[model samples]
Structures are given as structure tokens and as C-alpha cells.
Target: MTGIASHPEIAATLALKRRGITLTLLTTAYFFSYMDRQILAILQELIRKDLLLSDTQLGLLAGFAFAIFYATLGIPVARLADRGNRVNIIAIALALWSLMTAVCGLAQNFAQLLAARIGVGVGEAGSSPPSHSIIADLYPPEKRAGAMGIYSLGVVLGTAFGTMIGGTVAHLYGWRVAMFTVGLPGIALAILVKLFVVEPPRGMSDAQIVAEGQDKGVIPPLGDGFRTMLASGPAFNLVMGVTITSLIGYGHAAFGPSFLQRSVGLSMIDVARYVAPVGAVCGTISAVGGGWLANKVAARYGLHAQAWLVLALKCIGLPLSFLFYASSNPYVAVPLYWVSLLFVSSYLGPSFALIQGLAPLRMRALWAAVTLLVINLVGLGLGPTAIGVISDLLRPAFGEDSLRYAMLTFAAATPWALWHYWRAGVLLKRAGA
Candidate 1:
């Protein structure tokens, strides 16, 4: 027998060894997914200049066009995850997206680049929903926020690696090569996940007190789980809140590199070095710490954790958002942006964990996919495009300052998002969640 099979428990000191391994692989996979997606934002300045693209065109690529396919496909893929072998599907997606990323490096024109990005969108459509499903299967309710928080770390770390690497390489070699560099590594990692991460028993991460009362080894029907979430007011509110927040978040994502380039006069390489790492570190801290704190708060105050946490963070973040947009100094704006990211990044893990806790086992992927659909359609699909359109419209009058105002306008969406979270908190109590 192999070492793992021979020593089923592996090390005595390690607790929930299987869960640790599963989540690690899932997070790493997500790291590459985010890495490939984010590299473009870091390299935007170089790509825009070389392609001679308009802001509107860039926004379309970054926002609506990519997100349209990405969000639309997620549901079907998630439905497949509910019923089929998730690992094989995820591995295929990794390979497809990695190849598409490499293809992006080969584009010589705006149209070609747009098409390549769409390819990337199609490939990425397969990742998150299945991973969410898998996570719900591996860890228990109490551990989920921490687990998802660890998983959420991939967003910042991947962005850091992608941005820094893409920026530096683009600085040295050009943006094209940077695209290829960030994407190719995921192909290998996909194979590793398929080989090592076996699917755990469904609903293992649920409230085990409930699980213990039921018959062992029964996989709940996927439809039943979907209906559970569909009827959940708190869950629905949380999804909408996150989706709205994502709209503004994606706007920042679409134009942040360009903001630094036009406003701060940093070259692409400087963005990777100065901007990417800063956002990455802050974002990771916010995501992981937010989950940890949410759990701590929940233990004390119950489901009210996210409500208070989000309120405090948003109140602080709103001001930082203003500062981020108002400041012209990279030194000031960069750090301020990082601070804002800390708050924004914190939402994902806690929010996702909340959804997992609310929904039944089989439907976890479906609900995740459903949330992604709304977020991608409304948030990513419109945020960048709206900003771009507005910026272009303002350009004749405001000139270079147009982009700044457009970004500030999008930041206004945060308050509404905060309100939704607050409402979700109230509904959570009503639902007895």
C-alpha cells in the first residue's frame, strides 16, 4: 500500500487530516483560477497601449464580455457537479483555461485579445461552483468559515503572484509573455488535484448534530437543497448584497492598473511590484481574518457575526474608497487601496460560508453557481462597462480626470451593498439560521 493508504490517519497530531488536504488542493486550484484572471488587470496598461484600445473596449473585455459567458455557464457546470464527477470536470476546466491564457499571449489585435479573453471566461466557468460543492462536503459547519477563509486567501495570493509576475515580466519581456507565464502553471496543478483529491462523503461539513440524527450514508437530493436556499430570505439577501458589492469591486479590478498607470505614471512592471503585492497582501489578510473573526463573533453572538462585522468594515471602507479615488499619489492611493481591499476581501469567505451553512449538501454548488450568475451578470458584467462608458462620455469634458470620477461613482454602490448585509442579518435571525 502507498504511504497515504497505509497510514489512513497520516500523522497523529494532525486533526481532520483529510479535510486539510482537500481544502488545500481546492484553494490552490482557486489560486490559479484567480491568478490567470487577474494578470490582465496588472498588465492592462501595456496591453492597452500596445493594442491601442479605447477604455470602453477594454471595459467590455474586462467586464461584460468575459463575465457573460463565465456567469452563464456556471449554473450548468454546477448542475453537473451536483450529479456527476466533479474532479474530472474541474481538471478539464483548468486545462482549458490555462490553454486559453496562453492563447491570450498570442493575440496581436484588439479583436484577437477580446476573443482570447472570452475563451478564458468559458474555461473559468467550470471552477468555483464545483469547488464550493466539494468544500461543503469535506468540512463541518463550525470549520467552514475558517476553511473557506483559507480558500479565500487564494484570491489575494493569486492576484499577488499574477500581478507581480505579470507586471515584472511585462516590464522585462512584454505583456504577452506575462499572460503565458501566469496561465501555464495551472495545467500541471489541475492534474495534481485530480490525482490526489478524492471526493468526500456529501454533506460531511453540515451541522453534524443534525447529520447524526439521520440515516448514515444518504446523499440528499440536489433539488431539495436548491429549494431550501431559494426559500431562505437571509441567504437570498446575502447573495444580492455580495453581488452588488462585486459590481463596484469588479470596476476597481477592471481599471486599477490603468488608474495607477494614468494617474501615478507607473509602468506595467511598477504596478506588479508596487501595486499588486500591496493589494494581494491586504486582501488576503482581510479575507482570512474576516472569516476567523466572524466565527469568533458567531460563537459569542450567533449568526449576527457577519452583520456587525460587515457594518464596521463597510463604515470604515466607504471612507477609504473615497480616499482611494481622491488621491493622486500612488504612495497614498496604493496603501489606501490595500486598506479598502482588506474590507472588501473579507466578505467572500464569511458570505460563502454563510451560504454553505444555510443550504443543504447537494445544492451547495447550485446556490453558489446561482450567486455567481448574479454577481457576474450584474457586478462584473456591468460595473466595468458602466464605468468605461461613463468615463468615455466624460472624457471630452474632464479629459484624463474622467476615469477617476467614473471610479468614484461606482464606489457609491457600496452603501447599498452594506444595507443589504444589514438586512440579511435581520432576516438571518427571523429564519432562525
Candidate 2:
């Protein structure tokens, strides 16, 4: 045994059964992460009423407060992942965030809740960068897109379960109980991840190096990672594209339930019931399909395929997002929402794959952290807050229908995001050629 396969723990992970198990466990951890992050969206209304909070404040809690620390801290944590045990980092993050999420149930005032949410963000900062690095090591370049796509399914599944479970529990036992219910399971998940998942040597999946028993690479300095990203036009555009996409996606996610309830006259439970299943099914299909399609295209046409695929999806999805918000009838609007979501959500796997593929092996986690920092800051930090402020501004004119139009206003960003994706594709194609 040599390289990654030489380590006793990693040797077990090389077995097909253990590899699949690791992927499943990591995906499950991701599932819990989103559930903790997103449960607030579904329960925002209840929380607003109970705590006497405004939509803007709620948005800050959902978006800015969490995103601020999450984004800022991710870079350093990812630097740790580059040189340390990624599995340990992920497990510790899972436990910390989960504990904070549970603490949210104990908050009696706005300040306390905000503090708890910030703690949750700090913990979650450690999750994705390491997970992405680990996944990149597990699968070779040719198969990475699809593998990433499968892992991305955790987003939709977590959102779905969060909405459904949070809505139902909140309706019955109040939002506090819903928070507690969703947060505790992640602690157990963390323990499992720490015990079972083995860290593969960096660049283990790069065939040329791995087969020659030289998979390990020196961890580049943090500044070098930033320079690598800044020098690559395609990578920068991809980051911009993802950041904009996240803006629209997070804005819609944060406000969509409220819009449906206010404009469509559905209850919170009704919104969850209808939106969760549709979003779950469509998001899963689109995420996996996008990765599979990008892989196939890349196989034939080369490195730019994922960016091209993302551009196409955004183009098709943008108009449907407008229609989804504009329609009055729930039946018509919900189906359109599903189609729009499918297109928007499809980009994750390909986008992550592109980021990892383009990055230097030593800098992959750091680059991922930097990309996430931008995405969370621009997207998660501003998206929901912008919608909330806009909705409040339009309330005088549109009354209860204000949220609907505000979402539509945000939806217009889709085309702007599409342009970035197109630019990214062109840059990638030029670079590859």
C-alpha cells in the first residue's frame, strides 16, 4: 500500500462499500445543515408574530446575521481543512451548529435569537468547504460532476424536510418546538461522521499522481489561493454568476412561503405542504440532471461544458420565475414555480464541479471557501434583506400583495445572473482551447 491507500483507515475507505457509506453519511450531514439553516424560512411568520418583529428584521436573522460570520469565517476554516483533517472539521462544525440551532429554541427575545443564529452561522462555516474538498478527493474528474450533483441533492431534501417538518411542528407545537426538533439529530450525525469517515490524501483522485504514489501536494499559502482565483477570468465569472444566482434563489426561498400565504390565501401549513414536495422533486431532478448533462457535454466538448449548461438553464428559468410570481392562481403559479426552480437549482453541481476542477489541488478548499464567501455575502446576506425592504416599501401601494411584487422585482436578477454565466462559459472555452 502506498499513497492514500496505504493508510489503514483510508484503505478501508477505498472499499466500494465504505466509499458509498461515506458519501451517504456526508450527504446526511449536509441534509441536517440545510434543515437547521432553512427551518427559519418556513417559520418566519410565526416567529414574527410571536416576537413582534418586522420582515426586515426577520430577513436579517435569516440572511445577514447568519451570512456575515459564516462568510467571513469560512476562509480561515477552509485553510484549516487544506492542511488538517477535513472529516474532523466537518464533524465539529456539525455539532457546534446543531447545538446553536437547539439554543434558538431557548431564546426569549430578538437579541438572544439573533445571537443564537450567529452562532449557528459560525459553526456552519466549517461544513461545505471541507465536504467539497473531500468529495473531490473521492471521485476522479470525469465522474466528479455527477457525484457532486448527487451530493447537492442534500440541499433540496433538507429544505423539503425542513419546510414540511418545521411547518407541521410549528403549527402544532409552535416555532420553538420546531427548532428544537430539527436541531438535535445533527449531533448524532456529527459523531458518526467523526468515527467513520477517513481523510484521503490530497489529490488522491488525480489519476496521474495517485497511480505514481505521489498524491500529496504541499498546501499553498492562503494568498496564493486568492491570487489563483483572481488570475482566472473564468473562475471569477463563475463566482460572480453563482453569487447572483444565490441572491435570487435565497430571496425567493425566504419570501416565497409568505407570498403564497398572503397573495394566494394559503396557510403556512398549506404553503409548506404544496411547496416542499414540488421543490424537492424538481430540485433533485434538475441538480442531478444538470450534473449528468454537464459531464456528458464535458466528455465530448471539454472543460467549458458545465458553464454552458448553467447558462442555458438560467436563460430558460428566468422568464418562468417572473410568471411564477405574477400569476394569481395557486395551481398555475405553483407549477411554474416548480419549472423555474428546476432550472435555477440545476446549477449547483456543475458550478461546484467547475470551481473544484479549475482550482489548484492544494488550493481547492480555500478557493471553495472564497467562492462561498462571495455567494453568501451577496446572495444570502442581501437577497432576503432586499426583498424584505422592498416588500415593506411597496406595502403602501400593493398592500398585502407587496411580497409578491417584491419577489418579482428580485426575479429580474435572473437575466443579469445569466449574463455572468454566459461570460464564464466563454472565458472557460477560451482557456480550454
Candidate 3:
């Protein structure tokens, strides 16, 4: 036989290997990014009690403070990712967010903790956009959905580990200790990423260069990114759909542990022990499965398949979410929550894959940043805060049941988001045709 390097099959296999390594490192970084973000949800009760704060204050801390910085800073960071070294950007960001997360453990007051959380957001701002751009370069359109689905597992795994580890550690030690434990590991992960992850050439996976005949050496103006995205109907609709979904998802997630503790009469330890695992498994199945199914469907049915799947999943999830919070028994409510999370979690991979597929290569990172800007600002920034305000409003009448009702009320908006997905799918189908 000829030398292994001279064989075409061997070269293809090696390329796949490099892609796998890049995806694995990026996904791991994503895991820590989300763990640091979601750990606060599990520990909110402890923080509130220790800090002597209200639910509304806790909501602001969980939602607005982090999201505002994350969303705003994402644009500039994404610009940097587009023009400079994405690997370096991600590594430095991972280190910054990880360090800030550790500093959260030292907070003795609300202001200090809030500041640290914002710092975490600022650091995490650099993570997803660059990662998305890199993944798009590594995988061609046909495989991107499945690859993105795998990457989206960071959401499920992060939430799972955050709840499991944070709750267990807080129960054993304290919330501060829990934060330190989860936070410090990411710094080392950052160093690993810098040392090992290789950056691919932009547009390497695309069938045609989006910037054909343009200077590959020069970065396009920032406004060019916005113009390109706004000019695309499907891209705009995808952003709207994702933002609304995020509002509902983040709101529910922010209050879910507390809801179980208060509504189902479970202790924090119990919520972590039973509910966390169920939610994690359900979310992982839905995210990975949805992406895989979408890719298979898209292979036959075309680009609209992903959007149609999202629409269907949202439609099914709406009633399930209502049922989950409405039920009083943990046995009944937990299963319902699992089903609801399954459907809702499916949206991330499909939505993200669609964004990358639709956006031009030069604009991919910026588009991702813009999508996140709206999602974080409206969804992450407003969802928890809205729940908090509504809960406080209903508290005088419903007492502890207020949060449950608040979450249920937010679930009503899921159908609204489904409409956008439907519209987006129709547009995508037309564009493909």
C-alpha cells in the first residue's frame, strides 16, 4: 500500500479527527460557561437567605445584571472574533469568566456578588459567537445541525452538573464553596483550549466562499454584518423566535428549583437529587435527538425541516409547561417537567444551526452575537425579572403559590414564539426552492 498520508481516505479521516477535537474543546468550554451561569439558579435561595434579599432582587441578579453586560459586550467581542484569532479570544474569555466565577465565592454582600456575576457575563460574552463561527468553519451545512446539537449539550450538561454539584456542595458546605468548586476548573480548561485547539480557515466548510472576490485579508465593516442579517427574512425571524423562547426558558429555569422546593414541598437537597437528573437526561435527549432528527429530515425535506421541528416542539411543550407547574405532586409534576424540558430544550441546537446556515461566512460570528444580543437582552434579561415581578404581585393573594402561577403565565408566550418559527420555516422553504 501507498504511504498513509498519500491516501485520500486517510486524509479525510484525519480531517474528521481534527474537527472532533475542535468541537470537543469548544463544547467543554461551553459547559463551564453555562455552569457558571446556571449555578446561581440552584444557589439563589441560599444567596437570598444569606444576603437577606427578596425574590425580585434575586431575579435581577440572576437575569438582568448578567444579561445586560453579556448581550452588550458580545457585539464588540464578536467583531474581534471575526477579524482576529477566535481561538485566542475564546481562551482568554474562558479564563476571565472562570476567574470571575471564583471571585463570586468571596462576595459577602449583594452588590459584590452582582458585580462578580456581571463580570462573569462580560467574560462569557466572548465564548459563544467565536465558538459558533469556528464550528461553522469545521462542519459543512449538511452536518452542521448534528454538530451544533452536540455542542448545545453544553446547556443540558452544564445545567445538570450545576444543579447536581452546586446543590450537593451547598448542602454539604455552602453556596460559596460550591461556586469556587465549579469556577476554578474552567481556568485550566482555558489553558488547554489555547494549547490544543486549532483554528480553521474561514469559509473552509462552505461550498462557495461568501466573500468571493473580496479581500480575505481585510475585515468587513461592522455595519455590513447587520445589513446582511437584516436583509434576510429567515435570519430575522429566527432571532425573534429564539429570543421569545429564551424569555420563557430562562424564566422557568431561574425559578424551577425554588418552585419545586416551595410548591412540591421538597428540600433543596431533594430537588437536586431527584429533579436535576431527570431534567438533565430529558434535556440531553431532546437537544441531541432533535438536532439529529432535524438533520435527517433536512436531508430529504430541505432547509425548512429544522424550523418545522422547532414549531412542532414548541406547540407540544406549551401545554406540558402549564401542566408541570399546575400540578402539586412531585411525582406528577416531575414527569410533566421532564416532558416540557425535552421539547423546549430541542430548540437550541436547531435554532443555532439555522442561524449559522443562513448567515454569510463573513457575518457568522456577528450574526450569532446579534441573535444572542436580542435573546439575552429580552429573554435572559427580562424573563426572570418578569417572573419575579409577577410573583411579587400575586404574592398577597396566592402567597407561596405565586411563583408557580407566574411561570404558568409566562408559558402562554410559547405559542407566540411558535408563530415566528412557523413563519421562518415558510420563508426558509421558499428560499430553498
lDDT of 1 at 75: 82
Of candidate 2, the 10-residue stretch with the lowest lDDT total is: 8-17
lDDT at 295 for candidate 2?
91
**lDDT by residue for model 2 over 1-433, one digit each (tens)?**
2455457455545633466777888888888988899999889988888999888888899899999999999999999998888888999999999999999999898999999999999999999999999888888888888988888888878888899999999999999999999999899999999877877767767767656765355777788988999899988988988899899888888877788888877789987777788789998899889889989998999868788888988788888888888988988988898888788788988889988988888788999999999999989999989999998888899898989889988888777778878888899888872
Q: Considering only N, C-alpha and C atoms within 3 Å, which residue pairs clash in candidate 1?
A: 139-205
State each model's CA lDDT, in order. 0.80, 0.87, 0.88
RMSD of each: 3.3, 2.3, 3.7
- Deviating ranges (above 4 Å) for candidate 2: 1-17, 209-216
RMSD of 3: 3.7
lDDT of 1: 0.80
Worst 10 residues of 1 by lDDT: 6-15
TM-score of 3: 0.95
- Predicted candidate 1 versus true structure: per-residue lDDT over 7-102, tens digit per residue: 424421122455677688889988888788878887776777888988898889888989999999998898888777777778899899898998
Off by over 4 Å in 1: 1-16, 207-228
Give the candidate order by descending lDDT.
Answer: 3, 2, 1
**Model 3: residues >4 Å from true position, as ranges?**
1-16, 210-215
Q: Which residue pairs show collisions in model 3?
A: none
